[model samples]
Target: MTDTPSDPLKTTPLHARHLAHGARMVPFGGWDMPVEYSGITDEHMAVRTRVGLFDVSHMGQLELAGPDALAAVQHVSSNDASRLKVGQIHYSALMSPEGTFVDDLLVYRMADEHFLLVVNAGNIPADFDYIRSQVAGFADVDLVDSSARYALVALQGPAAARVLQPLTGADLSGLKYYWFTHGEVAGIRGMISRTGYTGEDGFEIFVPPADADRLWLALLEAGAGEGIVPAGLGARDTLRLEAGMRLHGNDIDRGTTPVEADLSWIVGWHKDAFLGREVVLRQREEGTARRLVGFEMVDRGIARHGYPVLVDAAPVGIVTSGTQTPYLKKAIGMAYVPTGAAEPGQTISIDVRGRPLRATVVPLPFYKRSRS
Candidate 1:
């Protein structure tokens, strides 16, 4: 029996509309959210072939303002803030003093003295508090939580550009990757970022909470003929998994360092000092004990989280995330294994429900869409 609660789940600004459109609601990260509208496979395919909309209001938004805001951010974040130009965005990780990951977030430079940080839902409070405490002596820097006051919607797929072109006045084509533009959509102003988690061409729109419903309706209506469907968390997971994207708690935790997770690209090794600089530097010099890698099941059985990995029939690591790919029609997953077993084409076995399933380590980002 599933452990669903009797009480209705917390809804987003677009909750009523999601219900009206036949979304299957499920509890996720303390919020009641849609797992899918039509079907996970169908919705997943739609985003790959055409377009799909996702209500990601559960994400947290934070604002930093003041003369010392940039310096404060530089001290706390792992990314090199000096490279960020106005209207530019960067994917970075926040590390604890011990060098463990706090959360992976997107940092947007709105202006010289103002910036925005988009963080994961589960880590909002902890991230906010850690950042607040680190800003000591950095006077004039004010932190504000704007998560509840705003709505975030992601439109992703091959046809995303065409569908969104009619509704916004900004030149969608001009926005480069990791760049954003401020514009009005159906008379409502917001910022549109050309970034997504689905490994496809897409945009994430930040709008006022009160205008969320209208914007949702307009996009659906406009994309009706283009086969844009509303996707949910279920499809989002599979899509991101196939794309080799990492989830905060699943693929990485407080005990995992960015270097071990293969996310060292997000860390600024050249920077003078940051929260986890010493630990990261040590890891760089000494190498990591374990590393995250992709694996495909060569035998039957689905490998779910917490499953054991075996080397010579002896347990060596644990699975973090897994899914049956609708596109590839195969079992795939990610896990943290000893560095010696982390190479591509390495033969390994995962214990799935008491059975050993044959699998091979492979390169990340199992799927790549045509960017052009």
Candidate 2:
């Protein structure tokens, strides 16, 4: 029997709406979230080809405001928050003292002294406490966990703006990628951001918890003719993976650093000081022993997480994330292999259930959406 998340699962405000839509619920990140609706492939293609919606309310939100809020944010975040203009958002990582990832998150500059942090669900409590601890020396830095008060929904794909533009007063076209504005979406006041995890032209709508279902159902009705389907975590993961986005716990965690994960772009080397600056700087100078890279199967086999990756019939590294990409129609995965074998076009082998399957290192993102 499949284990449902009824006993200790934290359901979102749209939990009933998911059930009403015949969604398959599962335990994810300490919450009862939709794993699939129509199907993973269908939903994945819907977002790639047309449009799709994802209820990402399980993500945690932290509100940081006060005199030293900027300092507090800069202390723990790997990116340069000092450069963020009001209403702009940037992808960043929360690093530990050892230069390893605490959690990868998005930093939203709401105002001069106010910032909002969108973090992964499972690391909320730890993130909150860690952030609080970081700001202990800074006076007047207030950390509030406002995750329960808001519901987040993502409308993604090429038709995202087309479907969402009519319902909101915000100039959807004017809202550039990684920027947000306070506007009414479907007559409900909230923050509408032109950001998404699907690596497409999309928007993440943040609204009051009580108004979640209304906006969800309304969006569905509005996009019924546009091939907009309710997507779940299954499609979400594949889409992000195809886009080369890293999962917090899988591709990056306490054991991995930005250097090894090929995420050096996020680190602000110019910044004076941060949690893991010293180690990251050293790693940048000396070079990482292993690096993350993308690969596709040469033989017929699917590589899963924790699968042994070998270069010369010996275990060199392990697979972090792997999947049969629905859109790519091939078995692709990301793994941290030795620096020598991390180059593109380098052939390697993945042990799939004791069988060595030949694979080749490709570029980071297996697929990129065309501008056309």
State the C-alpha lDDT per candidate. Answer: 0.90, 0.93
Candidate 1, residue 193: how far the Cα is off, in Å: 0.7
**Candidate 2 TM-score, true structure as reference:** 0.98
Q: What are the runs in model 1 whose C-alpha is more than 4 Å off? A: 1-9
* Candidate with maximal TM-score: 2
Which 10 residues in a row give candidate 1 its minimum summed lDDT?
1-10
Candidate 2 pairs with clashing backbones: none
Query: What are the per-residue Cα lDDT tens digits for candidate 1 across 1-372?
Result: 112467445579999998899899988866789999999999999998999999999899988889988888888888987789999999888888888888889999999888899998767778888889887768889998888988999999999999999999999999998999999987789989999989889999999999999999888988999999999999999999999999988998788988899988888889898898899899989999899999999888889989999999999999999989887688999999999999999999999899988999999988999667
Q: What is the C-alpha local distance difference test score of candidate 1?
A: 0.90
What's the alpha carbon RMSD for model 1? Answer: 2.4
lDDT of 2 at 62: 96
Q: Which 10-residue window of candidate 2 scores lowest in summed lDDT?
A: 1-10
